[model samples]
Target: MKRIILIGRAECGKTTLTQALRGHKLQYHKTQAVNRHDVVIDTPGEYAENRELARALILYSYEADVIALMLSATEDYSLFSPNIAAGATRPVIGIVTQIDQENARPDRAEAWLRLAGCKMVFHVSAFTGDGIEELLTYLDASSAADENV
Candidate 1:
């Protein structure tokens, strides 16, 4: 089992994405870090929270083959890795949520990721079930490729 840490802006469906992956509602907490038995952990994006979470995630990413970065369509700054398609050591993918919003543009987001240097970026809407499966497909394939490599 791999450990996937979900980090993104508040109200960016981090909880929803975890639930969808686990097929149940995700439990939130104050002191918890990694969820057990293949459970994905969720954390608040507070500066202190992120500073702490980032360390744990960096370590976890060392063991896991992938780091799924969540990005908010409604949140302009809800991104990581300073503009890249994939990150070092592990394959990274951009999860675009809130696609139902009026300003959520996948094309623009794709361009941003591409410009940022991300080799692969996928879009998803946790509410409408729009791009979840597609993202899953990409993640699975990328992870498989990563494993094979």
Candidate 2:
């Protein structure tokens, strides 16, 4: 699969999504540092929240084939600015997490991601395995395409 680096604010379910993609048991494990897996680079929420720390994400992005910007459906505001993906060297996709939440506003979150310049956005619920298969299929196809090149 194409290696992916996930970036987002704290508690946005980046870690959870990582576990889900790996088919591991879904547990609440706070990411304190960068956890490099074969296919995914799981980053701490603070890295995306602090400007200084966010540089670390850019560095890590070099090691990834794709970058994922995560947003929680319940977030009232977006941390990302418009056309943020335009600055990225790699393909940047958006993930709207926690779609199963009672107060989830997936449409609003999708709009924020689109405004941030994500050409592809996915609505996922890690707890329910929703959208997991499709995301995996996408990664698989991307990786396959890269191998062909």
Candidate 3:
């Protein structure tokens, strides 16, 4: 499996999505530091929330096969720049979490991610398992493609 580095603001469900992708039961765990699992690198939301720590994410991106930019559908605004992922050497994808939230607006999240230069965006709800399979499928395909190169 290709290793994926997930970056996002606090409470964007990066940890939950990592667990889901690993076939583990969903659990709430605060990531205080970079947590490297078998195929996922979960980072603290503060890394994205604070501009000073943003450099850490760039360094971490170099260690993964893919860079995943996550955003919550309920977010009122995007914390990322329009070209946030433009400097990444690896393929960057977007994931919109909290798709099942009552105030969820996946379209808005997708738009924001697109502006951030994410060519492929996935809208998922970890709680309901919605769109998880497709995300996994994409990851599998990405890994395969990486192996070929």
User: How many clashing pairs per prediction, in order?
Assistant: 7, 0, 0
Which ranges of candidate 1 are over 4 A from the true structure?
1-3, 25-32, 36-41, 47-49, 78-87, 142-149
Clashing residue pairs in candidate 1 (N, C-alpha, C atoms within 3 angstroms): 83-116, 84-116, 84-117, 84-118, 85-117, 85-118, 85-119
RMSD per prediction, one decimal?
3.9, 2.4, 2.2
1-149 per-residue lDDT for model 2 (tens digits): 78999999999999999999999999999999999977999999999999999999999999998899999999999999999999998888999999999999999999999999998899999999999998998888845443222
**In candidate 3, how many Å is residue 108 off?**
0.1
Give TM per candidate: 0.70, 0.95, 0.93
* Candidate 2, residue 92: how far the Cα is off, in Å: 0.5
Error of 2 at 96 (Å): 0.3
The 10-residue segment with the lowest total lDDT in model 2: 140-149
lDDT of 1 by residue, 26-121 (tens): 454343435433646565555213665556666655655555566667666535545543344766655666678898776766665555555666
Clashing pairs in 2: none
Which of 2 and 3 is ahead in TM-score?
2
Candidate 3 ranges beyond 4 A from true positions = 142-149
- State residue 128's C-alpha deviation in candidate 3, in Å: 0.7
Error of 2 at 25 (Å): 0.5
Q: How high is the lDDT of residue 67 in model 2?
A: 92
